[model samples]
Target: LGLALDKPLVAVETLAALAYNLYDTEGLVCPIMDARRRQVYTGIYRFAGHRLETVSGQEAIGMDELLGKLEGLDGPVTFLGDGVPIFRRQIEETFCQPFSFAPPHLGRQRAGAVGALGMQYYKEGKIQTAAEHRPEYLRVSQAERERAERERRAQEGQG
Candidate 1:
C-alpha cells in the first residue's frame, strides 16, 4: 500500500506571514517590510469588531511600485526590516504622510511576534498544522526572472 498524505500544504510568502502576524497581534494598519534588494513584503490590515483582517492579497512587491501604492493611501505608516538603509531615500521621498521606523531591536523577523499573531489567526480560523505550511517567496530571484525573460525573447524571435 502507498504511504498516505495527512495534511494540506499552505505556502505563505514572507511578507504575508509578517502582515498576518502584525494584524493578528497589534491591530496595525497597512504594515510593510522590505525584503532587501529593492523588493518589499507588504500588506494592509484593518480592525473589524474584535479582530484585524488583511486587505492586501498578501503578495511581495517591488520597491517603486509598492511606494506608489502606499503613497496613494495617504496615511501614517511604519516600516521595518533590513532593507531600510537601502531604500531610505526613496521611502522618504515617496511617503508624504507621517512615517516611522521600528527600532533596530524590534525590527527583523521575530518568532515571538509571529507566534503571537499566529495564535490570533488560529483562534479566528487561520491556523494550519506544521505539515500544512510553506514559505511564500513573492518574487522570483533576479537571475531566474532574467533567464525567463531571455527565453521569452528568444522564443519571440524564433516565432
Candidate 2:
C-alpha cells in the first residue's frame, strides 16, 4: 500500500471523500471520523479547476472548532463519514452554510474505495515497505495514560 504520513491525524474518511468527490460536485468535501470526546478527525478538500486542493489539511478538532473554520467558506459543503450522524443535528443548527450529508452508499468506510486510493497513491510514487509502515495513533490510549498515572502515584506513595 502507498500512503504518505507526516501528521498524526490518520484520515479514515479521506478515501471515502475522494470516492464521493469523483463526480462533478463542487463546494467542500468534508470527511470526518469520530475521535471520541466530542472531537473528530477531519479534513476539508475542494476540486478547484478539477484538481484537488486541500483547504484545512487534516486535523483532530472539536466540532465547534471545525465549524469555526468553515464559517467563512462558501456554501454547499457535502459532509460524509461515520461521524456525520453523531453530530448531524449540531451541524444542521450551527452552520448557516448550505450543507448535505452524503447518502448511505457513499458515506461509510468501504474497502473498495480505500483500496482504490491506495492504488492511486502507489501510482504517485508514495509507496513504502511494510517495514517502514507505522500506525498513526493521534493520542495515547487511555490505558497507557492510566498506567502512567498509577506509576506516578505509586512513586509518591499514594497508590
Candidate 3:
C-alpha cells in the first residue's frame, strides 16, 4: 500500500522481529541477534499477560558484552543470524552451558516472519513512520574501521 499510495514504506528491524518471535512463541526473554564482526543488534523483551512487551529496543552491542548479559539471565541463551557463523567458535569457547543453533531454515532471515511480527507490533501501537525505520547494522564493518584507523595513524605520523 505504501508503494501504491506513494507513501514512505517502513520496515521493522530483523533482529527485533526475531526477538519478538522468541518472546511470543518460545516464552523466552531477551533474544539477541549477532550482526557480525563481534557486534550485535539486541533488545530486552518479555511476555506480559496476553501480549508481548518490549522492555528495550534496538541496541549496538559487543559480543563479549552480550554474552555477559546472557550470563546474567537465568535461562538458556540461543543465537541465530548470519553473523552467528562469524563468531561460532568464539561463542562456543566462551560459554559454559550447551548452546543451541537454529537449522538452515530458521537461522536465516525470512520475510514471512517479519511481516507477521510487524503486524502484531502494528496492532500494539508500535508502528512508526518510514523515516523512523532503519536496518540495525549494529556497528561499522571491520574493513571500514581498520581503514579509518590506518588513516588516523598516517595523519598522526605526518603531524
Candidate 4:
C-alpha cells in the first residue's frame, strides 16, 4: 500500500528487525532468531554516520561460532530477538564483554518500525517499484519442522 502511493520501501533485511527498535545506541545490534539444532539466524549491524551498516553476513550458525565473532567485537552490544531467551545464560557466561538485551517493549518487530524505516529510505532516494517489491521472508514454520522430525523418526525405526 505504501509503495502504490509512491513511497520508498526499505528492505527489512537491509535494516533488520532489531535495527528498527534500537534508537539511541551506537554499538552493534545483533539480532538472532532461533533456527533450532543449536543454530540461530543472525545478523550483525551498527549505525555508521546516517546509515546503519552491516558488520557481518547474516547466517544460521551455532552458538559457539556466533560467540567467536562477537568475541572480536568491543564496546556495548544490544542482543535481541526470540533466540535470546533460549540461550540467555550461555550468552551471559560465554561473552567476556559487556552486553545487554533490549527491553521488553523493543524486543520484537512492529508495523510502526517498518513505516519509520520506509520514510527514511524515501528521504534517502531509495525508492522501489511495486513490481520490484518482494517479501523477504525466510525460515520454515514449526509445524513443518515437526512433520519432518516425525518422518525422520519413522525412517530410523524402519531401518
**Top TM-score model:** 2
> Candidate 1 residues 1-69, lDDT tens each?
111455532333345344443442333454456666666667655555545555566567788887677
Total colliding residue pairs, candidate 4:
0
Give the local distance difference test score of model 3: 0.64
Return the clash pairs for model 4, or none.
none
lDDT of 2 by residue, 65-140 (tens): 9988887788588888778889999999888888888885677766665665555455656665555666666567
- Residue pairs clashing in model 2 are none
User: Comparing 3 and 4 by lDDT, which wins?
Assistant: 4
Name the better of 3 and 4 by TM-score: 4
Model 4 alpha-carbon drift over 4 Å, by segment: 1-8, 137-159
lDDT of 4: 0.77
lDDT of each: 0.60, 0.71, 0.64, 0.77
Off by over 4 Å in 1: 1-13, 16-37, 46-50, 127-135, 146-159
Mark the 10 consecutive residues where model 2 has the least summed lDDT.
3-12
Error of 3 at 51 (Å): 4.6
Clashing pairs in 3: none
What are the TM-scores, per candidate, against the unseen true structure? 0.65, 0.74, 0.64, 0.73
